[model samples]
Every structure is written in C-alpha cells, then in structure tokens.
Target: MTNRIVDHPVLGKLTNRPPVTFTFDGKTYEGMEGDTIASALLANGIRQLRVHEGTGTPRAIYCNIGHCFECRVTVNDAKIVRACMTPIQNEMVIESGKMQPAPFKASPEEWPRTYAEFEKMNDNHKEGVPHA
Candidate 1:
C-alpha cells in the first residue's frame, strides 16, 4: 500500500516534508517527515496497533484528529501517546502493542452454548420463562 496520504479528505497531500523510513514492530514503513504516526500506519495498512492496557482487547485508531484516545502508542521512551497527532521523526522508535487473539467465546458455535446456559437460569419474568 502507498504510504503517502496524498488524497486524504481532511489533510490532503502533504507536500512540504521529505519522505523518511522507519520501523514499526520491526516492519519497515515509509512516511513523510511531517505526517503523524497514525496516518502513516493507516496508509501502510496497519489498523490495530495495540491491545488495551488492562482489558487486553484490541485497539486501533478511532479518531484521526486525536480527539479519541484509541491510537495511543509508545514512542521512544514515552508511553500513552496519541499516534494520530504525533509527527514522524527520524530514528524514532515506535513500539506497537500486539493484537489480542480472538476469544473462544465469540465463536459461532459457542453462541449456542451461551444461549442455552442463559435460557436455563433466566427467571426475570413472572412466568419464569427465558426470552429469546
């Protein structure tokens, strides 16, 4: 994928800064010097950067303008940075968190198991019948 955000709707093509190469989790990626880490990552097809700190759930960019805290990543020695607003710099170390594996409970076959268990003990109604 092209690492240049030339046709983006909001930022459009960045023509001022020169292109620079950097590594994200050992993968080499290229972006303009002025482009934000999140923008460059999206252009490079990297959607999920890390998992939530406590929940271990996958997280990625939610707001490209830094309003949301979804795109937080560790850069250099810094932690909890909004990647959407942080510009790229030479020799910057970006440590992206690993994606969480899909939970087994979310599988299609597991739905029946969960539904059956819910149906057995659900007694909220006066009739003691579980609602589907």
Candidate 2:
C-alpha cells in the first residue's frame, strides 16, 4: 500500500494528478503528478536516500522542507538538487548522491564544546564563503 494520504477531514479528498513514471538509482517507480521527488520516494517506502559523507551513516529526508539539504539527489544525470523541493516528472532519472565516507578523527573531547566554536569550525570548513 502507498504511504500517501488519500483523504483528510480538513482538506477533504485528495485529487491527485496523473501518475508519472520515473527511475531512481536505476529502479523504476510510479509517482503522482504535483508530487515532489522526496514525497514520492517516501510514499513508495524508500526511507534512506543516501549515505553520510564523514561517518558513512545512512541519511534520509529531514524537515521535509527545502531548509535541510539532507534529501539532495542528482536529477536527469546532471545537476544535484534538493529532492524535497524538486517536482517529479515523467521518465525523469533521479539518483541519490552517494557521498563517499571520510575518516572522522575527532573525539568528543576534541570536538567543539560550544556553539560559537561549532560555527567557527563550520565557517572554516565551508568553501567559497567570503570570510568576514
């Protein structure tokens, strides 16, 4: 069964658009029109989208909005985009970004102890951001 909400008291019945066929990671799946790629994947019971870069842990959609980029995926064998924000299209090829694992050497003590330190660390780590 699909994990979609077909009806609701507040919203009444859902009139979904026509189903769109697409491929994710070489596997075909059917999603309804006006559905975001992330929502479609979740409806189809796909929880995990990709792996974490540093620890190699699994990652999935978080926050459901475009704010959190945890649901990023490559679209049409080209640009990487936030799945939660991108609409699904027919025959569209979506591939999860398989971030390679990297060694995390820092222990709890070595890690930042405060939010300010964490911000500092992140600011330094991110590239192309103008230093102020």
Candidate 3:
C-alpha cells in the first residue's frame, strides 16, 4: 500500500506539496498536490482504473501523456476524461467502469436488467461529456 515515492535515489524525497483527498470508486485516498489523477492513483496504490469496454479486461494507465486514451476515468460525474492529463482536486469523486455505450433506444423490458439498474444508480449524477 506504500505507493508514495518516498526517497528516490536521485530526487530525494519526492512528495513536497500539501496532501489532497479524493475518492476513487467511493473510497477516499490522499494524494499530493500537482498530481495527475493517474499519478495520484498510482501513488495511492491503485492500478486498475477500468475494464475494457469490449473485452472486460482490467486496465490501468498506459501512457502518462494525453495521446494514448488509456487512462480514461469519470471525474466528478462530469464526463469521461483522461486521468493522466487531469490534475487532482480535493473532494473529487472518480468512478471506474466501462466506457459509456453508444446511444440507442430500447424498450424497458428489452434493456439488460443490470444495465438498467446501473443507469438508475447514476441518474442523479450528470455523465461526463467527452470533448470534441
């Protein structure tokens, strides 16, 4: 659980900023200021941010930059965003899950029961809209 880089050989003690608290999957963790969500999660010992939307395989941060699109996460129920580029903010609520599916119309009975329930749970929260 010790994810902080405490005494690096070259940089010495790395964490220098005040701590900020955020929630991941409903659990709170402390992260240093100036940390990207990905870095903060890693520092807090969290690897899996989500599952593959198509395959259901566990996924973590792949590229620390904004190009790879592998570090997508829902921030503050606002929209899916890249965790590597988004800086950590105190009291932020992050959710990990498959990417939102494409829009489609289906009968209430035709919708998958679990998906419907999940939608219900998220209804109070505004979905994060991806930027164009």
What TM-score does each of the candidates earn? 0.62, 0.72, 0.69
Instruction: After superposing candidate 1 on the true structure, give the runs of residues whose Cα lies further than 4 Å from its correct spot.
Output: 1-3, 8-17, 98-132
Give the better candidate number (1 or 3) by TM-score.
Answer: 3
Which residue pairs in model 1 clash with each other? none
- Cα lDDT tens digits, model 1, 16-53, are 66777878887788877777898778878888878876
Please identify model 3 stretches exceeding 4 Å from their true place: 99-132
Best by TM-score: 2
lDDT of each: 0.74, 0.84, 0.82
Q: For candidate 2, lDDT tens digit of each residue in 42-101?
A: 889998887776566898999888898898888987755899999999999999878674
Backbone atom clashes (below 3 Å) for every candidate: 0, 0, 2
Give the top-scoring candidate (lDDT).
2
Candidate 2 steric clashes: 0
Pitting candidate 1 against candidate 2, the one with the higher lDDT is: 2
